[model samples]
Target: MKKRRVLSLVSAAVMLTGIVAGCKSKEDDKIIIGGLAPLTGNVAQYGQAVDNAVKMAIEEINEKGGILGKKIDYRSVDEKGDPTEAVNAYYSLVEEGIVALIGDVTSKPSKSVAQKAAEDNMPMITPSGSEESITKVGKNVFRTCFIDPYQGKLMADYAFKKLNAKSAAILFDTGDPYSTGIADAFDAAAKELGMTVTNKEGYASGSTDFKTQLTKIQGSKPDVLLLPVYYNDVALIAVQAKQIGITAKLLGGDGWAGVQNQLDEKNMDVLANSYFCNQYDPTSSDPDMQNFLKKYKERYKTDPIMFAVLGYDTAYILTAAIERAGSTDPDKIIEELKKTDYDGLTGKTVFNENRNPVRLAYITTFEGKKEKVLESYSVD
Candidate 1:
């Protein structure tokens, strides 16, 4: 077995010298991992949560002697939710000699980073990027979250089978692949399930007013309204929907995870009869789940969101692969990652051929600013 030691400044400089050479020095033992996320700007909540949880996981792993007897050196860059910035951040991390990557949290930037990472065959995993094309870029790429199509179809099936809804309406962002992907899947699934789609409206991304769409949807009087967008858009649309007297029950995908923070007591009524698909059950009674939640709350002083839990899972999954391989070779780590079957804070995660995890979808609703998990379902 290999031994562990803290690398001195001189030893670290030598490792960097090896990186500057043609090949990395295996004799210098320390695993370098890179993280990319929008730590500021639009989707800061998602990125901050992921970054915090990943750091927490790394701290715990280091405390336990780390993988392969080498402590992880984590380097993170903020992409600020921009695709170009995310690609730039990816290159920066690669220059710093990262063996593996976790991030580019949202869908668009994740796809951008994944495409670039594929060129170098870097083992990359996005914790909360639901875009299906993210892992399709390369075999070395994987994700801890389910794809957008899966989430859309899951919500559609839930609406039809569980809620027994006869009709539905959709509001999506035209510029966002994430929103449109889910909307398209939901439309097809709802139609296939014999539910009527009264109105399917698309608006430009970053639009503040949704009354035009909501008023149009009101004319159809659908039983449910689907908003397959991020938390900011969800908050805006919910307020606007209420203003237009749209009384349809609200439904959404995992992107709705942090929407509660965007609402106050006055507007909370808009989400009274609403539910959304999530990555995990926040109210789980399971011991592992409770322990994670407790630690996360103590560390961040806030309840862990789906992205946070996914980030925590990704760190463990990546390090576990490194430990199992017992080598820093990217190929060995990638192969070990392909066989992952770890039950994490979120749920059982087994990677499929596409490198998408097979996990349960949780249906959650807000109850007086607290999230209540109502049901859990799995889709093939």
Candidate 2:
């Protein structure tokens, strides 16, 4: 009877040990991240680029070894370019046990996600949302791209000094926070520099008919026209302005970064002297940038845009924070991120108190088939 009792106790101990081992295995296998992007909607191209870049970064990290010896898994949900949907997406990812978030490309969606993430104390980094308000939310929110004020000031200075344009007209999209922020900054800077902003015109987002607005701008006959709008709108406005015989020198913010691709040869010629600010330049002498281009091309079969580079850098920043924290604790990661001063593809990045990148904005112009870097100016 004594022997039988001892045998039963040993068997029970073995079963308990197996159960604990199973639970440990399950815990060790779970290290998932969340990506929020607009995979379907107006800004889908940019969102998809960001998503692809993040996925590439994850795959490269996993190939070496994942963080804390656990494989990193990511889930991307389509926000559909809606702010409310973006909020829902954030909650869903949090419910799914995602410790970090990368997402919501535009300013509106990023704003929505950032607000909720800040409230929950979740660590998040935006890839391409350049509105100034994003980082101002809290320490939990970060961005790889510089804000509109930086780009606006850079462009305003460039127009006055380099382009020799004293008087300019402002054409902006009021519906976009990004555009409005840039427009406001540009107007203030132009006024400070003694440059005359002859007229300021606002257009509704998604409006292709800008002839009337362009006609008004043309009437002003300013030396330059500063367009703080996106590529699609810029292209439409450029074509209409040309039709109405407005030959003023065109200038733009980073929203016009890829405008050439959206225009034909004839349309591009119409905006021949146009220049815009950009975050990354492939022609840069930075060895890190060169290596990034090589690796990105090898993986994606195409060169990366400023957005893609920003997305990749955003992932690296998050990974570095996680590695520095040595755990997935949200507060610990946020603390580590505040101390980050790493060199990214664009340049050396140091996050301010608001978690926005402190870096220079590069000025580039559409020179026929490519963009030419004119200059780079740092933010004061």
Candidate 3:
């Protein structure tokens, strides 16, 4: 009887192992997509928006009978806006057998993960990373926003022609590729527009003191200050610029993704009359855009910033590629993504040979936490 009991126990143990293996296989069977975001830092608002917006898209798609008749699984992780951390998040998601990736919202980390995705032959689409070099990593990589040259030139032209600015000063981060690239393009455009660049200076990333540079720009007394920096830095710079009595109009790129969240009521006045380049007009009246905004607000109980629009579009775009490819294979998805010209909430997004989307850059201005759309520009 004792021997019989021992044998039964051994049989039960074997059955348990089989059950665990079966569950693993079931999870592995589902098609997985990965997302990377900086969900815990100063710019966490952008990442959080991307994360939530994509998850909402995934849910909507699933409810309508997920892609290819299989329920889609998402493995999204936060990298805290660090490049190395972003790579680590990528590998973790890769282990879950993801067929494609979306994320690394900022340029530096997105560029890092894009290189890794290239090596792995993974299809990637960055919702917000605007660095020009990102798409050049590989054909497997794509983006939903225009690059710096177009954005910079557009800003310069707007200042010179729209705002009637005769001179500009640029202060950017030398260590940041995005900052430098936009600054270079702006400088060239300023020259072409016959606007003098009275001052151009570079400060390393994470530098707290911009008063020195602001003083120099104040001395130059330009009509506009091209502050091609991130939102956190911009908040500080904006305050300092006002303190130093530099009243030049401020401008920036998409790195100022969630500046409104960073500013207090007192600080909002400082950013008044400033403009920034953005991927989408959050208050657009286009029917499609209006629908998206309505649905997004219904889900989140608030209007979304630009990153949320991008995140939703990126997911929407990827799902389109998945349907077009009719498979979860990365190679097939990349092929389909390249041929895509989807009517997105942001704009009609068409990927170029470099897999970068040729889309409109909305010149957005702030009126004390209220975003006003100035105009939109398209690159040829």
Candidate 4:
């Protein structure tokens, strides 16, 4: 009887192992997508927006029977805006059997993950990493937003033709690739358009005081001051410029998208009459965009930011590629993604040879913390 009991226990253990193996096999069969975000950091707002949007898109797709007739298993990691942490997150995702990846929302972390992903030939797409070199890291890397150079040139042309500005000054963070890349392109395009670039100045990152730079730019008396920096820096610069009594029209890239939220009631006055090129116009009248806004508001109880729109679009784009490929194989998905011609909430996006999106820019401005879409510009 003791021997019989031992044999029965051994049989149960074998059965349990079989069940676990079967479950693992089933999990492996599902299409898995991993996301990396800076979920807790100074840029947490951007990361949170993207994370919410991506999950929303995945939920919507799953409700419709998911991609390739199986439900998608979405996993995400918080890298906390650190480059080294981002790479570690990618490895964790890869180990979890993810067939595709979406994220590392900011430029530097995105680049770090892309470098590692490229070595593995993993298909990865960044929703809002606009640095020119991010996609240049590997063919496997792609983005849904226009690059820094594109935004810079677009604003330069707009300033010259629409704003009728004859002179512009640039103040950027020399330590930041996003800021410096746009500054260089704007400088070149401004010169090409016969707009004088006056008093180009650079500062170290995390500097709270820009009065020194503003004073020099004030002396130049530029018709426009191009600040191709992030929203926080833009806010500080705008406040300082206003205090210094500089009247140059403020212009920025997509980095300035959420500056309105970063300012207080009194400081909001500083952004008056400022314009920035962005991914999408929050006030767009397009039926698709309106529908997305409605759904997003219903889900998040707030208006979607530019990063949210990009994240939603990236999810749709990636899923569409998986559907077109008829498989979750990374190589197959990458091939289909290359042929993407998605008319998303952001805009019609197609990957250029460099794997960057060929899309137009929305010239957006603020009116007392409300974002208004002024116009859209294509490469002409």
Candidate with top TM-score is 4
What is the alpha-carbon lDDT for the whole of candidate 3?
Answer: 0.86
Rank candidates, TM-score, best first: 4, 1, 2, 3
lDDT of 4: 0.89
Best by lDDT: 4
lDDT by residue (258-317, candidate 1, tens digit) is 798899888988888898998888788999889989999997899888889999999999
Candidate 2 residue-pair clash tally: 0
- Tens digits of per-residue lDDT for model 4, 1-380: 99958955764565456445534654744788989999997789889889999999999999999999988888888778888778867876776678889997999999999999999999999998988999998888999988989888999999999999999999999999989999999999999999999989999999999999999999999999999998989989999999999999999999898899889998998988799998887787889889888998998898788899999999999999999999877789899999999999988999889999988888988889898888888664
Against the hidden reference, what TM-scores do the models get?
0.89, 0.87, 0.85, 0.90
Q: Give the worst 10-residue stretch by lDDT in candidate 3.
A: 14-23
Greater TM-score among 1 and 4 belongs to 4
Per-residue lDDT, model 3, residue 203, is: 97
Model 3 per-residue lDDT at 328 = 83
Deviating ranges (above 4 Å) for candidate 2: 1-26, 285-303
Residue range 1-380, candidate 2, lDDT tens digits: 99958955764565456445534443447577889988887878788778888888888788889887778887787777788778876776776678889877888889988999989999999988888888788789998888888777777888888888889998999888888888889899989999999989998888889889889988989988888888888888888889998988888877787788889886678667778888877688788788878888897787677678888888888888888899999999889988988887877888887788888777787678688887877646
Worst 10 residues of 1 by lDDT: 1-10
Clashing pairs in 2: none
Better of 3 and 4 by lDDT: 4
lDDT of 3 by residue, 1-380 (tens): 99958955764564456445534654745678889999997679789989989998898899998888887887688778888778877876776677899888988899999999999999999998888989898889999877877778888988987889999999999987878988999999999889999999999998989999999999989999998877888999998999999999998887786787788898788888699978888778898788878888898887787889889999989998998899888889999999898888888888888888888788888876878878886545
Q: Report how far off residue 115 is in candidate 1 (Å).
A: 2.2
